[model samples]
Target: MIVQLSDIELTARTLVMASQILVILLGFTIVYIAFQGYRRNRSRPMLFIAVGFTLIIGVQAISAGVYVVFDVSELAAGAVSQAAQLSGLICILYALRMEG
Candidate 1:
């Protein structure tokens, strides 16, 4: 039995999907923790962090929907990907603001 390159690529893609699912679950967990901290501490900064994570998750969810609707169009897919990247960057900046 010989394993071909295509089989390897397929396996990689499957692993990537699994990893993505794990990451999304982790993100939800973080969001939950942030929400709890915000509630307990009543800190404006923590609230901001929670909102940022919520925005990031919302953007990703919207992008996923866009991909489902426009999967056949490369342009549409690229636009959604770009939007997701931008939202993710904004989330990073928001997270960094905790230090400032």
Candidate 2:
């Protein structure tokens, strides 16, 4: 048996790309909003949120690169992206716990 680029795979990949675009854009917007909040009243939690979003944006970019540039399997890309996402959240949690 042989396999070719079928319509289903193409459709799925297109959907993934579109979602990635939306995720990255939303992450950037979150970071921007957090930055503005931090700047307005100089809040520590807002700073942590901004930093978290920055890390999240980086992770999203790398995940998309793996999907589009490296052409990794979807499962592998999801695993890597999930790990990075968790790590980013952990950092933010630590930041929140620490004294500022």
Candidate 3:
């Protein structure tokens, strides 16, 4: 069956996709800055922070791709993305607690 989206729906989806792309770009920029901080200070905490951000954003991006490419269910994709984000948050928390 072929379904067609209304103009508003199409525009909304387009805007959402554009926003997601922008978010990915911004997220990577943050990761780059954190990695640079790690390089400058040689801090394990900073390294972990960078990794955490990467995992969070990278999994989100990948999950979107997987959803589109594999035609996976939205619930499954969301679950995978949420799990990765949870892991990433744990990394960030551990970094915060780690002693310098």
* C-alpha local distance difference test of each model: 0.71, 0.83, 0.95
The alpha-carbon lDDT assigned to residue 82 of candidate 1 equals 70
Candidate 3 CA-lDDT value: 0.95
* Model number with the top TM-score: 3
Winner of 2 and 3 under lDDT: 3
Itemize residue pairs with steric clashes in candidate 3.
none
Candidate 2 lDDT tens digits, 25-100: 8999989998898899888888888888787787769876879888599999888788878877976897688775
Better of 2 and 3 by TM-score: 3
Flag the better candidate by lDDT, 1 or 3: 3
Model 2 TM-score, 2 decimals: 0.67
List TM-score per model, in order.
0.66, 0.67, 0.89
Candidate 3, position 38, lDDT = 97
Regions more than 4 Å wrong, model 3: none
* Clash count per candidate: 0, 0, 0
